[model samples]
Target: MPTALLDLILPPRCAGCGVPGALVCPRCAAELHGRPACRMPVPTPPGLPECWSAADYTGAARRAIIAYKERGRTALAHPLAG
Candidate 1:
């Protein structure tokens, strides 16, 4: 499979910091969880889906999303969901 071949050629790396070994490092993962809190939008957009954010969109959390989506690091979904 193309994915399998690519895996062999490229070592797994954290989507957050690009550290080889894991899809998302433990530290970056920890940043994704906390007491779930309600999030509001500025001016409160109409028909916005009710959702909660694990952390503010910055640093590791931001980078991880970009990596997972743009770089195809699907493995990050587990940690990002934490």
Candidate 2:
């Protein structure tokens, strides 16, 4: 389906902040984009490869993840991936 047509029926909203408009508002997108850092959990599991993340699992980033993974907002996958 055409994106414009789909949006007309279910308006796009920022996956992170729930703001109307873009799937991820400029502010949230900026927040999600950052230097990748090693965010290994405590007591690293055996054979776990080094994990790097661009944004900490909190605030807008956390909300976005929940929306994509838990809430079934699959449309957010593209923005969140970036």
Candidate 3:
């Protein structure tokens, strides 16, 4: 409903590169999760016992997180989670 109207009014663009016509372009999606998952940090956060990040919170990854968490674009989660 609202998502459809918003797309019609203002076409969506890739959160990473601003490429129009897609929530996230295929090119940028491939760049995600490049490193192997692991518990690498020396002193883990207070109560976080262990954690594994898909990718560093920087560049396209950061923009993707902001778009999903702040801007309400849940579409990015599917690819981001992979």
State every prediction's TM-score relative to the real structure. 0.70, 0.77, 0.72
Error at 28, model 2, angstroms: 0.3
Predicted candidate 3, C-alpha RMSD: 2.9
Evaluate model 2: give its TM-score: 0.77
Worst 10 residues of 1 by lDDT: 1-10
Residue 38 of model 1, lDDT score: 71
Task: Tell me the deviation in Å of residue 14 in model 3.
Answer: 0.2
Tell me the lDDT of model 1 at 71.
69
Against the hidden true structure, what lDDT does model 1 obtain?
0.75
Candidate 3 local Cα displacement, residue 73, angstroms? 0.6
lDDT of 2 by residue, 1-82 (tens): 7554666798798887889978889999987887899999889999999999999888899998898888777777888788
Per-candidate RMSD, Å? 2.6, 3.4, 2.9
Model 1, 1-82: lDDT tens digits are 4543666788877777879887778887777675676777777889988767768767888898887788676666778776
At residue 37, give the lDDT of candidate 1. Answer: 68
Point out where model 1 deviates above 4 Å: 1-4, 47-50
Comparing 1 with 3 on TM-score, the higher-scoring candidate is 3
